[model samples]
Target: MRILLWHVHAAWTTAFLQGPHTYLVPVTAERGPYGRGRAQTYDWPASCVELTPAELAGADVDLVVLQRPEEWALAARWLRRIPGRDVPVVYVEHNTPRRDVPDSPHPMADRDDVTLVHVSHFNDLFWNAGGTRTVVIEHGICPPAAEYTGELDRVGVAINEPLRRWRVTGTDLLPRFCEVAGLDVFGIGAGRLRGLLPPGTGLYDDPPQHELHRQLARRRVYLHPMRWTSLGLSLLEAMMIGIPVVALATTEAVEAVPPQSGVLSTRVDTLVEAVRWLIKDPETATEVGSRGQAAVRARYGLDRFLAAWERLFKEVAPCMSTPSTAR
Candidate 1:
């Protein structure tokens, strides 16, 4: 099947290329994380083709897959003009939107032709959109074999966007924890901290995935302070490397990590205590890390994720071929 995947977010392209099928991606004018538009191109597989929006207009595409809700208007317009206009469209929600709006203003929430896929089961339960075909597909990680040999004094934190007054990410809590625990934090969005964080905290505007993984493996513990959202990819990468994680017990995190892997608590005192405990007891920390690794391998491996996607594709394909009764 000829599939057209629309990924506004750069990371989704990495995962989309894993399937053994012909995939088409839209080339964007905006530069990505690594560098200038020339420096950071997507690492697409041999089976995939990158096309311009104008080229896509004339191509014979089967399915238009969207990774975020904001892209619904664009997909809707594309669906209306494509030859097989009734082709199946899928929307994958990577994070829960700000649902606290007076009334949920999500346009595709009630869309009949669009199927919603969530990255976490917890997200599916929390997001209330009636009459929508919703499925939970958890994020997967590449398993690690060798144990990490990095120093334990460093703690790694990653955030794509800084927390504004409207959105909260637990970044506010990091400085306080770092000060109390005497740990060095390497992170993105350091500007968000401005005068809050002490000296010597490593900050980067952007880093490649391979480099990010390398840095994360060196850290003794991975600290996630995200107050509202589904499980972040950074947390999974740390767990896969057998690095213990200390995060807030909110959103999908409570369901993603086990008690043995690390401590999950909302209390500041509890988090502070957990950080200290993990730092002092290397053996216990390693044990927790091992459990996290095992959990990720068993539950969120790539093979399992691809198999689920294959099954979903098969189920939706026939629906696309059938004519709707509305017409």
Candidate 2:
């Protein structure tokens, strides 16, 4: 099947493109937000092809997977096909509600023409679907090959635009964590935190996914400080890399991190203490990390993620089928 999707979330898209299907990604000469084309830092299969707006005008795509709200209009303009009407469409809700807590109505609410897919149960419950068809497809990823060494006594965190999304991404909480252990931050706008962060904390600005995993595994424990998000792929990647996790017990972090696997709490002091203990006792950290790794593999494996997507695609376009694995 030919799938039309934008390169919105890199880690998620990377895993999504691994299946046996041709992925048509929109590309603009500017390579801006809408048309970033394929990922340059991370590796992707040849099956993921890039098409300019002019090229997409003539392409016959089997399904349209919408990420952002604006993509609905872009698809109609570029492909000359109205989503949900001209082509089967599935809108992926990748974020937690930013407006009202539990009262926030989803943008696609009450829409029978499109199906809304949530990445976490927390989002599914919080976002009032209001009669909109919805399903939760929780996050999954292809685990990196790196193993946790925990040689460094520092904490590792991965979040994009931490400066802009300060409180939301828990950038305000970083200083408190830094009081316990130095933090090595990785993501876009991470470098902006330099000089602003406490001394000894390191900043890496959007490194490649493989490099990020490799760096994260070296830290004694992975810190997920995000106050609200669907489920950070980086947190899952850290667990998959066998790193002990210390996360705030908010959003999906509670479900993602089992008690034996890591420490989760709403109190910052409790999380700080947990990180301090994990850094001091390397043996305990290793054991906890191993448990988290096993749990993540069982629940969020790449094969499971892709298979669920395949099922959804089949349901959306029954006539379409996975092509040969030639790519």
**In terms of lDDT, which candidate is strongest?**
2
Collision pairs in model 2: none
Residue-by-residue lDDT tens digits, candidate 2, 1-327: 889999999999988888888899999999999999999989989989999999999998999999988999999999998889889999999999999888999989999889999999999999998998898887778879789999999999999999999999999999998887888999999999988898888999999988998899899999999998889999899999999999989999889888799999999999999999999999999999999999999999887888788889888888896555422
Clashing pairs in 1: none
In order, candidate lDDTs are 0.68, 0.91
Per-residue error for 115 in candidate 2, Å, reads: 1.0
Best by TM-score: 2
The RMSD of every model to the true structure, in order and in angstroms, is: 5.4, 1.3
Q: How many clashes (backbone N, Cα, C below 3 Å) per candidate?
A: 0, 0
- List ranges where model 2 is wrong by over 4 Å: 322-327
